[model samples]
Target: MVTRIEWLDAGLELLATEGAPAITIERLTDQLGVTKGSYYHHFGSAGGFKAALMEYFEAQFTTRLIDTIDAENAKPRAKLEHLLRLVLADPDNAALEIAVRAWALQDPDVRATQERVDAARTAYLKELCRGVGADVDPDRYAQLLYLILIGAEQVLPPIGRAELREIYNLTLRLID
Candidate 1:
C-alpha cells in the first residue's frame, strides 16, 4: 500500500521537475504507479495534496534544517557554516526552490507559503547573526543574505550550486 509520505514525495518531485501545474491527481497516480483512490485516500483532492505538499516542503526544508543545525550544539559561526553545508549538499534543493518560486508568482496559496518560508529562514539567519555578534544590523544583514539566495535562484539559468556556495561563503565572510 502506498503511504502518505510516498504520495507527498511523488508530488514534491513532480512539483520540482515540472512546476505546480504538472501536479495533478493523474500525474501523481501515474508517477507513483498507484490508483486515483490512493491519491484520494491520502489527499482527498488535488488541492488537498498541494496544501499538504507545501506544508511538507516548509517542514522538511525549514524546520527540519533548523532543528538539525541546532542539535549540533556548535558555536554560532559553526552553526552558520553547518547550515550552508547542509543547504548546499542537496542539489535538488535549488531546483525545487526555483520551481516553487515560480509557482508562488502565479498562486496565492503558494505565495503565502513561500513568504512564510522566507520569513522563517530570515528569522533564523537574524538569530544566528546576533549570536555570532556581528557588528552589522542583524535584520539588514539577514535580509541581505536571504535576498541574495532568492535572487540567485531566480536568475536566468540559475546560479550553479558550487558558485552559489562560493557566493554564500563570501557573504558570510563579510560578517566574520
Candidate 2:
C-alpha cells in the first residue's frame, strides 16, 4: 500500500519535473505504479491531496529541517555552517524549490504556502544571525542571506552548487 508520505513524495517529484500542472491523479498514479484507487484511499480527493501536499512540502522542506538543526548542540557558527551545507547539498532540492516558486506565481494556494515558507525561513535566518552576534542588524543580515538564496535559485541556469556553496561560505566569514 502506498502511504500518504509516499504519495506526497511522488507528487513532489512530479512537481519538480513538470511543475504543478502535471500533478493530476492520472499522472501521479502512473508515476507511482499504483491505481487511482490507492490515491483516493490515501487522500480522499484532489483538493484533499493538494492541501496535504502543501503541508507535507512545508513540513518536509522547512519546519522539519529547522527542527533537525535545532537538535544539534553545536555552537552558533557551527549550526550556521551546518544549515548551509544541508540546504545546498542536493541539486534536485534546488530544482524543487525553483519549481515550487514558479508554481506559486500562478496558484493562490501555492503562493500562500510559499509566503509562509519564506517568512519562516527568514525568521529562522534572523534568529541564527542573532545567535551569531552579527555586527549588522539581524533583520538585514537575515534578509540578505535569504535574498541571496532566492536569487541564486531563480537565475538563468541557477548557480551551480559549488559556486553557491562558496558564496555562502564567504557570507559565513562575515558572521564572525
Candidate with the greatest lDDT versus the true structure? 2
The residue-by-residue lDDT of candidate 2 on 1-176, one tens digit each, is 88889999999999999988999999999888989999988889998898899999999989988998999998777877788888888888988898899989998998999999999999998888888886778788889888988899989978998999889888877767
Task: Estimate TM-scores for all models.
Answer: 0.95, 0.96
lDDT accuracy of residue 146 in candidate 1: 79
* Candidate 2 TM-score, C-alpha based: 0.96
Off by over 4 Å in 2: none
Cα-based RMSD of candidate 2: 1.0
Q: What 10-residue stretch in candidate 2 is worst by lDDT?
A: 75-84
Candidate RMSDs in order: 1.1, 1.0
Cα lDDT tens digits, model 1, 1-176, are 89999998987899889988898888888888888998888888878988999999999999999999889878988998888889889878888998888999999998999999998999998888888887888789888877887788878888888999899988888787
Alpha-carbon lDDT of model 2:
0.89
Query: Which residue pairs collide, candidate 1?
Result: none
